[model samples]
Target chain A: MPKRYVSIWFRYLATDLHSLCQPQLKSIPFVLRSPSHGRMLITSSNAIAESKGVCQGMVLADARAIIPELQVLDDRPDLKEKLLTKLAEWCICFSPIVAIDLPDGLLLDASGCTHLWGGDQNYVNDIGKKLHARGYDAKVVIADTIGVAWGTARFNRKYQVVSTNDHLSILQTLPPEALRLENETVERLHKLGLHKIQQIIKAPRASLRRRFGQDIITKLNRAIGTEIETIVPIMPVEPYQERLPCIEPIATRVGIEIVLEELLKTLCGRLTNEQLGLRTSILKCYRIDGKIEQVDIVTSRPSHNIKHLFQLFELKLQNIDPGLGIELFLLEAPRVEDHLPSQEKMWEGSVGLEDVRLAELLDRLGNKIGTQSIHRYLPDEHYWPERSVKLANSLQEKPIISWRVDEPRPVQLLHTPEPIEVTAPIPDYPPMLFIYKGKEHRIVHADGPERIEQEWWLQQGQHRDYYRVEDEEGNRYWLFRLGHYHDKSYKWFLHGFFA
Target chain B: MVVSKADIFKGLQTDLLRLQGLKSVNNCELNNFLGPIASAFPNHSFPLGVIHELISHRQEEVAATSGFVTVLLSMIMGASGTSIWISASRNVFPIALKAFGVDPDRFIFIDLKKEKDVVWAMDEALKCGAVSAVVGEIGEIDFKTSRRLQLGVEHSGVTGFIVRKASRNIGTIASVSRWKISSLPSEKSDRLPGIGFPKWKVELSKIRNGKPGTWDVKWFDGKFFPTHVPIDTLVASDQWHKKKTG
Candidate 1:
């Protein structure tokens, strides 16, 4: 199958955008000007200004002399690039591969996309009509190669769909500049009486290469389909992606759910055959109004279960707003991992973390609330209470070392210790009484000054003298004193509560 | 003839308890772990596949209740079964669970910011039959939500525990039993100078169709040891013995 490409050239991109924002500027002749070589030069002009004497590359003062009532607006440095990028993203509704042909044009790989709109002619016409309705004077052309489409969209009077077999016939009539050569090279060809491409096409290859360098031959070969050309798309197509194009715009929740179910079934089917599972997926809904609404879901582990994946996506479907209605739905899985199918067992028993149902339940919960809130901890080799446990990276991660149960640890450890007022016998003895949160507790049974020194390699802090003390009411509290009892500024804090 | 009449009455009572979705204690292997507390539950068995409400008003009580619940979880999950703990603000240290004979890695901890999410996560976890138990820490729960959780566990056979923290009003809920646990001063049997194993005053405030009593229990060597039988439970057991032998 031959590949087809489309190029859209915005003739008055800057002026047209200005006119769209300020509707009153539509009737008047205006030119956008920018500072160049210490002088204001006209960068772009509206159709009305071009119909008059004002044109691009003219000095602002000279343009004003021609049309005294011409309105001049400041031209932003990156406005053209920004507008082209936005237009290219919008063109994704037409084709998946859209690239910005810098300055004023967009290139699209319309290989198999044109059949959706009937044919190449109707596809180009639809794009041109939609762009015209948006207040942009866009010239669109479709051809067998990007070079021919790009040159024809800019220089041709009307949109044309050049057939695959008529590449040289089309290039022969156009001027030598149609090959996309440098301006200096085009001028040299013209000085040599080679104004038409037909004359250049018939010239000897060695002489042409000697005169114009190898760039012309490479460009010519690319244009005639003798060499291949690749485009860098704005959004790279995902390896595991499914697309659903709606014949009629859909707006209801049920309609969206049906589309999501179809996409999931297709994507999951492919993953199952390859023994792969999706970890994260994104669903993009292209609205008829040219705005894309997207929702994404992440799984705790790799999964290819369609029902489970759909349930996770269903939790986040409310975030999508179908203004006007959506015409296209695309699901792309960005992260995937190898998944080995679990063998069926004869009897039901404990499966632990390897259970697929548990992963699905966690995925549903994580999608509803957040993934960060769900955690499984493994023991770390540290004495500090906060540093004793570390978050497990995944469900399959195992504890390298067993938990330290030799020493006494509190049932509930406070994130930050609360200060307490204590009365003690001094010299590292446990407190006799302590007041915390405006309440007084008389200690009856007291334990040790288990000194835990701070690891200096990780941080610097005073050693804590911990005591497991029971109050008169039988409520046990873990209290700690900072530094030594003889220190001038020694203080006590209630660190935790023991069961 | 008199023995047959008593046996028939006991059989009818067991059937009635079974009608109310309480499995008989004869079928459960966990009866020995709870000791005499198992007799306080319907059918003289520790209830499974039902919601249990644990109330705590202070930080100390919360810790005690957490310890008691972790002991039950260790028994329920056994060695390889998994569990989930959902809380708004988690204060339970994971490492401490090892002291209760539970592998910390086997328990998934979900720390949410809202009580609503905690309850929702607990409900989801309960519906998942792969886990043995689900524990949730929240401020309050009403009858409707608790009933939904009860319905979820009835089918999945997963036990649920909701720890109500700092709740001022104990509202009506659909839980099968309600408990309140507070720390008790450890007894130094060896005349040691330091504190001993954790002791808790376990109070069964409510049970659907069984006796509610308080008992003193202590945890050491990775098991619950009944320190002593309170007078109330002793009398109840005496009556139960009389009914069986008289």
Candidate 2:
């Protein structure tokens, strides 16, 4: 049976965050050393460097003598792990099943998706091209077995393929070492006058299995295509997706609208069929050049209505450019879940109309203004005014309610409390006359000091005394002073105002 | 008889009951905020729906960030959800908000890189819906942008508070309400030179239905509770509401 496998290799430069983050040092000759700058662990990519007179496990002093220009970097496994994780996230665009082959490699199961971009060869070429364009030297090889592909991509490039019937013919031309056998085993084979893989192929299978153990022969046979290898492809996740392949390339707005209507119909059909709805749907204009432009619409609730979906698409599609004419349209439901349809008692009654209209309006406004420019607030458990509120996107779930200070609270809240010099009656009392924002204010009347303690777990926690004071003009303000300002001037701030 | 398209359609309808047989039910109005504020808003506490304008604003001052913080703190103390503050401004004062009864552990502050970052954080926070409200500082706001935010709030029913340092007269944008706040006077003590009982000249610049004018208010103790603030009155408390509090 035809099967698939992946080969992974890594290129690493030992350096702390500076060198690791710097794009220029990726190509430089470097070694990762321990914090003491002691022993150097030559990276896997240094095989070429080793052949050029460099050696692994060499002292820094000796290596410096061999290559005066060799750059030194501190090994940071933590940083490398972070970088690998980020790279894996970026790979989600290509394949869903991305496994970390660690220290710097990723194994992507691209078997099924190979046809999406033409074929396996083309897919590997595209991946290599993308990685190379991004300033990385990458190598890729695909074969029936993982062991063969791994060995071929790393060691023997020319003999990458081994046909089933021709495995004997191809196996003989390569050296016995190409099989990634132990150095001791190869040395023994050479002493036995078995320098070439063909010599081993001709040897009696019973003797080879008995001498080297059955594991060796089984691995060898698998690499030579005598046995089958299984590959696990990453399955596509169900994010609401809708596609419209146009009969003709659509360029005009009317043509786009027609396509959008048809696409909405399909999307709604899928939603109904799947018994699911979407809080958000991203409409993709898949151009012929394989470029995709997206416009996302958020709904208050999961909906499966064709007309409502069309209205949102209409607003979102207005800004999309059908450049060079759009041949295909794809709508992906990025967020979808099960939704219980509301049963209307009356046929003429508007069923979930308000929520739908609100969602459509939000979608329209999001398109017109900008997706990031607008936000709603959610509550966070923090006393700091700046950290108390959170930004929310409307597409997911609605926050239940806004935070309300039941007791007396400030009408105007300052982002940051600036220190004000005050000559108060006492250190604990509110300032009688204070200079704030370059202006001086006289205290006509005042209130109590609401003591708020800092969270000890935090590093810069402090104790504060907050007061709500009224000036002669009846303007309200929230003011506080940091406790225990021994040396520096006491820090006072105007926090908020009353409504 | 051989079935035509019309005959097939008729046959399909034989088992289908008329939709007219279904009885109509009244739409239940979505209840938004609870407690006294459940009725404070004309639309019942700004139901979790998108509004063109959130966090009513009348003036654009870099100093107004404190005002934004107070609104956020109030929501957190009174509402059912969590609170988060995404501050891209260098002027973020965490100490002051702590004094306003906001739970210190509940607040999460994310320092973003750019002005656009505040908006991005806001979008993510709004989508989470785990929090009750969000507050962010923006330099300027346009109609279309406010519309988008309003839609976002409406969709999730999360209230949003935007603090813009400067204003360029965005005439008649949609907002539940708008208010202009400035520092008033604080109380005095013989030992201290600074004021107490922070007062504010709060002008309701724009409200959905309420009057649009200025009201002299005081942040007494810690709340925005009504107080006898005689700012324009010629007489002091000796002649004014002193009769009541006294």
Top-TM-score structure, candidate number: 1
What lDDT score goes with residue A220 in model 2?
76
> Per-residue CA lDDT of candidate 1, range B1-246, in tens?
999999999999988988888765353657677876778977677888889999999999999999999999988888798999999999999998888888999999999999888888998899999999999997888889999999999889899999999988789799999999998876645435677777888999899888999988876545466876432343356654696588
lDDT top scorer = 1
- What are the candidates' C-alpha RMSDs? 12.0, 14.6
Residue pairs in clash, model 1: none
The TM-scores, one per candidate, come to 0.68, 0.45
Model 1 — TM-score against the truth?
0.68
DockQ of candidate 2, scored on C-alphas against the true complex (2 decimals): 0.09
Please write out the lDDT profile of model 2 over residues A223-283, one tens digit for every residue. Answer: 7767754544434355566677887777788988887777778788888888888777877
Distance (Å) between predicted and true CA of A489, model 2? 16
Span of ten consecutive residues with least summed lDDT in model 2 chain B: B20-29
How much of the real interface does each model capture, measured as fnat?
0.85, 0.13
Docking class of 2: incorrect
